[model samples]
Structures are given as C-alpha cells and as structure tokens.
Target: MWFKNLVLYRFSQDTDITAELLEEGLSHQPFRPCGKTELSSYGWISPVPGGDTLVHQSGSFLSLSAKKEERILPASVVKDAVNQKVEHIEAEQGRKVFKKEKDQIKDETTLDLLPRAFTRSNITRAYIDTRGGWLIVDASSFRKAEELTSTLRSSLGSLPVVPPALKQSPAATMTQWLEQHAATLPSSMTLGDECELKDLGEDGGTIRCKHHDVLADEIINHLNTGMQVSKLAIHWNEALSCIVGDDFLIRRVKFTDTLQEQSEALNAEDEASRYDADFTLMAGTLGEFLKELITVMGGEEEKEAAGWETKATVTVEEGVEEDAPF
Candidate 1:
C-alpha cells in the first residue's frame, strides 16, 4: 500500500528496541471487533491482511496497521426515540418527566439503538525504522497519528518519540525561497504550482495559490508584506513531489514515474515479496530525501527546543518486565 502523507517522529539515538519485542508488545492489543453496545474500538492489526505476523518486517524496517471501528448513530434519531419514550412514560404515569428522568430515558434509548447502528472501519498504517529510531505514520492528521502512538505507548508501557522540529522556521525559509527564487531555494528542490502563505501578525490573514507561479510578483508582494510561507508544494530530488507544511508534515506525496518503472523492473513474484521490495525502496529513498531536506533546513543540532523533549531512546533494557497488561 502507498502512503499519501507522513507524520515523522524521531527517537533518541541511544534508544534500543528490537523487532521481535515490538511484535510481542503489539500482539497484546490485537484487533477485535466492536462490542454490541460499543460506539468505537481501536487496536493493532496485521499490515498484510491474512498474515499471522503482527509486525511486517523487512530488514530493519517494520510496519504495522491500526484498525478503528466506529458505529454510526444519528443524534436526531436518538433524540426522537428519547422523546417518544419520555412521552410514553409521562402518559402511563400521568406526570411530566423531569430533566433527570428525561436524561435516564436518553441513556436507555442510546443503549437500545447502539447494537443496531452501522459501523465504519478505518486503518492507519505506521512504520518503525528500528535502525534510524524513527516512527513514520501514514496519517495526514496529527490527532490520528497521536492515537496510534498513544496505543503503542499503552501496550509497551513506554514510548520515547516526538515530532521533528528544525532549528530554523520552515515558514521563514519558504518565504525567503519564494522571494529569492532559485537563489535561496535548495538546488535539489524546486517550487511547484501550489502554495499557502499566512500573515505572521494576528490579523495578517492567509492566501492559497494553485497552478500559479510561486515566484510571481503578486505572490512575492504578499511575502514582502510580512506574510510567512506556512506551506509550499515542491518537487524534491527529481524523484518525489509533495506539499511540505510549516509543521514539517508532508502530504499528497507522489513518486515520479521513473521510480515506479524501476520498481516494476524488479518484478517481485508474490504479494509478500512485492511488499518487501516496495517497502525497502520507499524507505531507502525517503530516508535519503529527509536527510537532504534536513540539511537544507540547516541540519538538526543537539539543542532541545521548547515543547520538544527527548524521552527514552529506543534502546533495549535488560531484566525489564515485558509482561505489562494491555
């Protein structure tokens, strides 16, 4: 499966964790269908469907998928049912149902309707670079990514991971790149046709452009007016294209046809083999791209910024109890 977005997190270099241990920890929270009256449920699932392996492994790269099931219950339907029950109780007892009684009736009605509610299922994919101490989630939303990490933390009893924060602000860098055109922009990256610029001040406002020259005078004027580049689309290293946000999230990722052709030439025989090949190819390429992008952003230093703390490094600790309840 291809990832449309990435939420990157870095772990301390000293942190040690083995693939086998990760698999064991995740097995504690294996996917289970929602209960009769449950509105939502979440748990880990096999990255490769039908495979007994909870963690899909290829070299030091490990992948897993989290499944979430949510039941659909309309508020109007529940409210209507609650009102009908309230009316029936009032008629039978010949007294008006008070707020407390109405609240109890609503709870009862919700429980009765829950089992019959239709459910929708979704899966979020995440990969762990054991060698690199990186956890990359294929989620566009921060909340969804946090959910996956939260479950992992609960299962493992500890998780030392945090989002990447560069020393220099990406918004400032992007704004400078647009203002200076090819001069300030990294040689390996070129501006694409889409971008988003926001004012640095409280009421500075925002602007979005599509299929327009990012280096045009009109766009430059906004950047000149103290608006910072919060998001910009760029083609990097001539292999991948994506919209990079100020928060460092990459979205709408697309690999060039040349990369796809190279992958096709490999011609893996089975599903598992193909998955391994694809994962390796993607991880290797993106790993390099990320390194270059970091360098472009003036490289990561040892300094810790506010709100960005290095928790436990992903290292193996001996004699520790691994048998924590899920």
Candidate 2:
C-alpha cells in the first residue's frame, strides 16, 4: 500500500539491523486481540493482512506494522451507570454516597462494561531504510508515530532515532518562499494550490486556502501583512506532491500519475510481487526526494536541538557511527 502521509525520523548511521533480526525482535510481542476484560492491546503485526511474517523486506527497505485495539466505553455511559448505582444505594440505604463510594462505583461500572463494549482497531505502517538510515512512518499523527517507535524500542531493548531537524526552521523558510513568489525555489520544486498562513502572535488568527494560487496577489497580500506560511503544498521533481508543515510533518502525499504508471508497467502477477514492485519504486524515489528536500531546507541541523539530536560524525578508530548524510 502507498503511504498517504509521512512522519520521517533518522536512525544512527551505524545502527546495523537485518530483516531476520528485526523479525526475531518483534516476535517478542506479536499481535493478539484484546482480552475480555482488557481495555486495550498493542503489539506487532504483519503489514499484509493474514501474513505470518512480521517484517516484509523489499530491497533495502523493511516494512513493519503496529496494531492497536481499544475497547470503546464512553465516559458518559460509565458516568450514567455509576450515577444510577449511587442513587439506588442512597435511596435504599437512606444515606448519601460520598466521593469514595462514587469512585468505587465508577471503577466497578468500567470493569463491568469492558467485556461487552465495542472495540476499534487500527494499523500503523512504517518502513526502515537501512541504507539511508531513516524511519519513515505513514501516519499523519505524531502521537501515533511515537507510539510505534515506543513499541519498537520496547521490543528491541533500544532504538536510537530522532526526527529530522533542519538548520533553517520550516516556517521561516516557507515564509520566505512565499514572499519570493516561488521564483527562487530549488530545482524541480514548484508551488501547489493550497497554503496555510498565520500571524506570529500566540493567539493570532490563521488563514487556510485551497485551490487558490499561492503566487496570486491576494495570497501575497497576507504575506505583506506579516502573516507567515505555516503549511504549503509543493510538488517535488515530478515524482510526488505533499504539504509540508511548519512542524516538519509532510501530509497529503500523492505519487504522480507518471510514477504510478511506471510501477504498473511491472505487470506483477501476485499480491506479494505487486507490493514488492510498488514499494521498491516508492522507497527508491522517496529517498532521493528527501535528500533534495533537506538541501532546500538549508540542510540538516549541525548540532543537537531542543527536541532532537543530530547524528554525530565519528571516526572508524572510535568504532562509532558516522553522521547521516541526508
């Protein structure tokens, strides 16, 4: 399956791992449905439904999926049940139910409802680029990406990775790009039809536009009025298009029709073959796009920052890893 969104992370350059090794590590906590009384369950699962393998290898990329099943017991329902029990007890015993009893009743209600409550399940897919030292997740939510990384760390005992940080903040760079009217963008980069602009103040207003020309005078007027571009749609090298946000998260990713047609030319006869063909093409192109993206954003940050650490360059004599090139 193609990834609709991307939340990218960087792994240490020296972090050596193989598909078999990753599969063995993930096997420590395989997916299992939530038990009758359990409220939730989280574990590793095959990216392909009904597949037995935990790690699916396609050339240099390794795909993994995390499954999370949660029981849906609304707080309002629990409160209603607890209130009913509290009222019945007070009415029959002729005594007011205090906070302690009310809390106990609430807990009891939750446990009683847990077994019968409906459940919802979702799968988060991600791929590890061993060659480029990147972990690319197909989730728009940062929280979901962190959850997958957390589970991976728990399973493997340690995972040294951090989000890609750039020397120039995305907001500042995008703001400048908008001010320039897309005339100074890097090679093969072009403005799209959507953008989000917001004032700099803490409580300032935000403006979102879609199907509107970003270089039009109307949008430029907002820039002249001190609003900054927080999110912008851009097409990269004719391969894919996505909206890059100030938070450095890429959303609304779509591979170009030409690229899709190229993958289709493979003429895969089975599901596995088709998946492998598509992924191989997607990962190969995405890797190149990221390198140019990092360059256009003023390259990766050189030092450690508040929320992330840059991979350090180490010498072979020290038996340490080199800094990630991209």
Candidate 3:
C-alpha cells in the first residue's frame, strides 16, 4: 500500500524482535468491535484483510495496520435525551435540577445511547524497517500518527520511537535558500511554485504562496524582515516531489511514472510475492530520497530521544489497497 503522508520515528535502541514475535505480540490486541457503552476501541488488524497474517513482511520491511472503531452518537440526540431526563427529574423532585444534577443526567444519557450508536471505522497503516530502525506511518497529521504509535506501544508493551528534531532548523535553512539566487540550491533540488513563510516575531504571522517564484524580491524582502520559511515544495532528482515542513515532515508526495511502471511490471505469481516485490522497489527509491534530504538539511545527531528517522521508503507506486481507509 502507498503512504500519503509520512510520520517518521527513530528507534531508541536496537530491537531484536522478529516478524514472528511481532505477529505474536500483535495477536494479543487483534481488532475487536466497539463494546456496549464504549465510545471507541483500537487494536491491530491484518495488513491484508482476509489474510491470516497480521504482519506483512517483504525482506526487512514489515507492514501493519491499526483499526479504530468509534461510535457515532449525534450530540443533538444526546442533548435532547439529557434534557428530557432533566425535566423528568425536576418534576419528580418538584423543582428544577441543579447544574450538577443536570451534568450527571447528561453523562447518564450518553452512556445509555452509546450501545445503540452507529459505528464509524478507520484504519491507519504503518511500517517498520527493522534494519534501519525506523517507523513510518501513513498519517497526514501528527495527532493521527500519535494515535497509531500509541496503539503500537500498547500492543508491544514498549516502543521507544520519537520524531526527528534537527539541531539546524529547516526554517532557517529554507529562509537562506529563498534569500539567495536559484543557482545556489543543491544540484538535485529545484524550488517548486508553492511555499509557506512565517514571521519570526511574537505575532507569528504566516504567508502562503502558490504558482509564484519564491525567490522573487517580494518574498526575499519578507525573509530580510525576519520571516522564516516554514514549508517549501521542491522537486528532488527530477524523480520525486513533496512538500517538506520545517519539522522535517514530508507530505503530498509524488513520484515519476517510471517508478510506477517498474511496480506494474513486477511479475509475482502470488499475493505475498507481489507484496514483497512492491515493498522492495518502493523502499529502495524512498530510502535514497530520504538520505539525500537528511544530508541537505544538515545531518542530525543520533539520539535515544523520542523522534523519527527515515527507514526503508515506500511510495504510492506500490499500488493502493482497494480497501484502504484513505
């Protein structure tokens, strides 16, 4: 499956857990439906639905899925029920219910309606590169990524992974790039038409641009005025493209069709074989891309802190799972 957004994490220490062990550990928290009176439930699920295996592995790459089920109870319905209950209590007591009593009634109403609530489900896909000691999640936002990591930690007992934080800020580096001539950029990098700049002062004003050369005098003047580049879109090596944030998160990734053709040409006889081939190709390409990105951003010092690092990289070129939850 292709990852839309990357939330990279570096392993805190060397982990010796094997695929078999991971599968065993995850089996303990296999996905289950939401229970009565429960607002939500989260657990592990098969990376390939209908497949018996929970952990899908292609070489050193391991893929997994976390499923979350949340009950959909409309707030209006709950409020109406609570109001009715409050009225009944007030009539019984021959007086209006106190604020405390009304709050309790609201809580009770929610609990009563939860079991009958319809459920909405979402699945978050994640992969680990055992050799590279990285965890990559296909979540567009940090909150979603954190949810996936939290579920992983709960299942595995301990997952010491954190987001990458560099000593040299990307914002400052990007600001410098914008203030300079286009010829000064890395040989493999070309600025795209979109960017986000933020003021460095306490007000923290932000500006976003599209379809405009970021190196223009107007943009440079803002940088001269202490506005730092917070996000930038760039084409790398004429093969990969993405919007990279100051925090090192990469989103809206697009790879050339050459990579797609290679994936389609993979002639695996079985589902497992096809999966392996896809992961290998995608990971190899992305791994190289990330290596270059880290080098350009100024290499970060290795640490045991909670942060993420690029492991084996994969892209949408692997083909999307028809059942993927976006």
TM-score of each: 0.91, 0.91, 0.87
lDDT of 2 by residue, 250-295 (tens): 8878999999899999998888778788888988889998998888
Which of 1 and 2 is ahead in lDDT? 2
Give per-candidate clash totals: 6, 0, 11
CA lDDT, every model vs. true structure? 0.80, 0.84, 0.77
Question: Candidates 1 and 3: which is better by TM-score?
Answer: 1
Top lDDT: which candidate number?
Answer: 2
lDDT string for model 3 (256-317, tens) is 77776787787777776666666677666777777777777776665633233323112221
TM-score of 3: 0.87
Q: Deviation in angstroms for 272 in model 1?
A: 1.3
Off by over 4 Å in 1: 303-326
C-alpha RMSD by candidate, in order: 7.0, 6.8, 5.8
Q: Which sequence of candidate numbers ranks them by lDDT, best first?
A: 2, 1, 3
lDDT of 1 by residue, 1-326 (tens): 76778888887544577778888999999989889999999999888757778888888788889999999999999999998988898899899899998888888889999999999999999888877768998877677777788899888888887666577888877777788785865678888999998887877787888889988999989877889888888898878999888778778789888876777789988887777777778887788888888777766656354354556523211211113110
Clashing pairs in 2: none
